[model samples]
Target chain A: MTLSVALGPDTQEGTRTGTAEATDSLTAPDIPWNLVIWNDPVNLMSYVSYVFQSYFGYSESKANKLMMEVHRKGRSIVAHGSKEQVERHAVAMHGFGLWATVEKASGGPGGNSGKSGGPGQGKGKRG
Target chain B: MLQPEERAGQDPLAALIGLDMDVAEPTDRAVKRLLPNVVKDDGAASLEFRQLTERSLRETKIGALRAAALDLDKDEIVLTPEGAKHWSMALNDVRLVLAERLDIRDEEDAEHVHLMQDWSQAEDVESYLALVYNFATWLQESLVQAMLQSLETRR
Candidate 1:
């Protein structure tokens, strides 16, 4: 994918340092499914952000924002699209060795209210 | 468990080609981590999804690994962007498998493994594996940092 418009060097460098934390979650109104990247001990934070930037063509700052979310919050909904779109992204993420899962943006019956739930949802850190 | 070998029915070609039509959910936790359910808390749907997609996913990973291996034969390896991407993916996968074997389930476990730096201190299998894992992690991290720089330049 083509890279989007460039930001200042300072903006890119700020993301690389990664001290900033994103308070608001990423959201897409029309997209019905969410692709969530979960935190793991094995994956490097920089590698994870790089995947977000390269694979999805997210801006560096945006990618680092999501990566930090996963690092600090245990998980982050990094992408939103149709079921097929998100599922396809999930497979790509698995290919990259990142733990990812797709879910309906509108939580299903008996599912946790996804919007209100904290980042801890469905974070089953198994062996 | 996702046992392709047993299912390939003694056909070396089938096994070599990774042809398993009736693969089950992986019982091995490490394998499970590698090929996790796409949908959470829904095994039936996840299994169906896996049957449809897991084989190709495995092949994609294997292809990346093969590409990286081929590059290793050259005296001084130089990576095209595609080659670099494949190497990054290959190294990440290696780290994943090693982490599973090392039982690095959380940050604390990872730090414990990271402490195994000295080659002379490799007394047992686990410690040796930890060192390898740390090395892979370091290698991947450096590769990614370089990639990020490239991204910045292109931007």
Candidate 2:
């Protein structure tokens, strides 16, 4: 699939003093964000795999592998890209009724090391 | 319930949601697919999720499908913003169910249906299910596109 790689608007420039500046040199763009799909009781496995294939243009085996990862691991990083792209992917996943979220790639800025909530975070209907 | 002739006046969403019980209650494979486990490897959590949300999810899907089946007799379907959202969700639910029944796991499974020469030669159940699966996929894709278009216009 064609990925849109425009520079993300919400790039946070990390500022540090002394030794801290030497260690934390990761740029916002370098710290990729992930679009995650959480396991849900409603969506079918095949359907989830199909979405991964159709939306991301993943090969059938890759899509199936990712679907299985979500099924087994409770969540999977379905895409890695700029925050804007990741957020867009999350929205599309939500449009398909899958539980989705966007988060700073593990060990990114703000030290928020886990999946952060996106627009459609809750377990309910789309607004 | 309206007679076949009176269905033109009936709400399209209602008509879709009011599918005969037999049509709604698909085989075990479809049922398992429609209601998949949320917490894998944790039987208790999976059961809990099912206990808490299965009925409500089913009810919500049925409600949305009913709302989407609004004006079946009309040649063109024009949905309000709210109707479009409901239609999208309902169509996804229908496609999920149909895909499961057809045993469509990957591109290969989908290709089998696409490559069929004639449904007349297939078993009655297989042919009927293939038709339903294809129809549901078309409807779901159309609704998703419409919803995306609506989103673009609002932005």
Among these predicted structures, which one has the highest DockQ?
1
lDDT of 1 by residue, A1-127 (tens): 1011232122243535333333223333455567888888778777787899889998877787777777777788887776678878998999998999887666643122334543344334211
- The alpha-carbon lDDT assigned to residue B79 of candidate 2 equals 79
Candidate 2 residues B1-155, lDDT tens each? 11122333555654454332112222376555555444334344335444444444556666677787765556997778777767766767676566666676655576676454455766788777776656555555555555444443654
Model 1, stretches more than 4 Å misplaced?
A1-30, A108-127, B1-21
Query: How do all models score by TM-score?
Result: 0.79, 0.49
Task: List DockQ for all candidates.
Answer: 0.39, 0.10
Worst 10-residue stretch by lDDT in candidate 2 chain B? B18-27
TM-score of chain A of each: 0.64, 0.61
Model 1 chain B — which ten-residue stretch has the worst lDDT?
B1-10
Q: Stretches of candidate 2 above 4 Å error?
A: A1-75, A78-127, B1-27, B73-76, B117-123
- Model 1: lDDT of residue B114: 82
Residue-wise C-alpha lDDT for candidate 2, range A78-101, written one tens digit per residue: 777765576556545644567665
Local lDDT at B155 for model 1:
89
**Per-candidate local distance difference test:** 0.74, 0.54
Interface RMSD of each: 7.7, 9.5
Cα lDDT tens digits, model 1, B48-121, are 67766888788888899999999999999999989989999999888878888888888888878888899999
Give candidate 1's error at residue A18 in angstroms: 18
